[model samples]
Target: MVRPKEFDERVALTAAMQVFWEKGYEATSIGDLTERMQIARPSLYATFGGKKELFETALRAYVELSLTYVENKLRSMPSVKASFLAYFQGVIEGSGGSNPDFGCLCVNTMVELAPHEPVFAQITEEFEARLTELFRKSIEGGIQSGELPDQLNPSSIARVLTLTAIGLTVTMKMKPSPSRVEHVAAEILTLLE
Candidate 1:
């Protein structure tokens, strides 16, 4: 007897994610989400519960989506070193549109809420850990395949890469450009090489 809802949930969620990315969790109002998502409050509540819940979903989605993007780039290149080079180059290139100034949502959230909120700290920590793990795996792969020197410590290198990414994301928000992002990425790759 009940009719199904009509709006595209994924699109709305992605929009909400963008809004949250631009404005931190605490600063984003219901009106902001409704406006950005093109949905009424009732529908938003029915689909995503509330602002907190929606923000959590957005954060998780951002992490998953970003990880997938990085993974694909790292896996597709001819060499592991090249994979990372392209990946970081892409970061500096920005999204190639408006909102280039919006940095990593997870990092922004960490800066805004992690100090006061344990939940955010956990999310931010997980985000960093995942990046570190991804870098570690890629470096390990390079070592196994003879693309990199065996004596190099993958863990330390990965930590450094992760830190570089964090720093790049932060810097991009202030002034995002291909030259800047590439410069940092290239310098970081120097360690890998």
Candidate 2:
């Protein structure tokens, strides 16, 4: 017979996500996960497998949450331009304008682990592709509605916006001037015109 889990897996995974988000995969230790997750070492292993597997699971959760947020934000405004603006502003003012406090977990993973780890590379790449598709779909809606120029290539513009977002997320890690980052975001939106 098997015993029931003492703690909520979702809650424990969220805690582990925060730990991995703050400290990259290499920097985070099993002790850090167990301590932050409030679980014993054996329980951590039994529940989440090894540290790498736990990180992968945590990353997937983050990606799902992030994609949902992006989709909702993109659809929140009727105007595609306004939607993009809101999205960029949200990035700049993340949950009280402290987004740079940790930077994006997926982007951070891309920089820290993707280069050396094929698994991470694939995960981050899939994230980027999915994000780009969301942007592309939003842009297509604008074109269809006659809000944006029909000649504009949604695919190309989406790629540019996605890359810009990734770059901005990485730059935010440097704690640069908020105004400057906002300026870059503004310039990116002009691609729609």
Compare the candidates by TM-score and give the number of the best one.
2
Looking at candidate 2, what is the lDDT of residue 99?
Answer: 58
- Candidate 1 residue 10 Cα shift, in angstroms, is 1.5
The parts of candidate 1 lying over 4 Å away from their true place are: 1-3, 95-100, 176-182
lDDT of 1 by residue, 47-158 (tens): 9999988988888898888887778888988799888988776766664232447778888888888899888789889989998999999999999999999988999999
Q: Write the per-residue lDDT of candidate 2 for residues 1-193, one digit (tens) a residue.
A: 8999999999999999999988888899999999999999999999999999999999999998898899999999979999998888777667422356688889999999999999989999999999999999999999999999999999999999999888877877787876677676577789999
Query: Model 2, stretches more than 4 Å misplaced?
Result: 96-98
What are the C-alpha RMSDs, in order, of all predicted structures? Answer: 2.2, 1.5
Candidate whose lDDT is highest? 2
TM-score to true structure, per model = 0.90, 0.95
Q: Which ten residues in a row have the lowest lDDT in candidate 2?
A: 92-101
Candidate 1 lDDT: 0.84
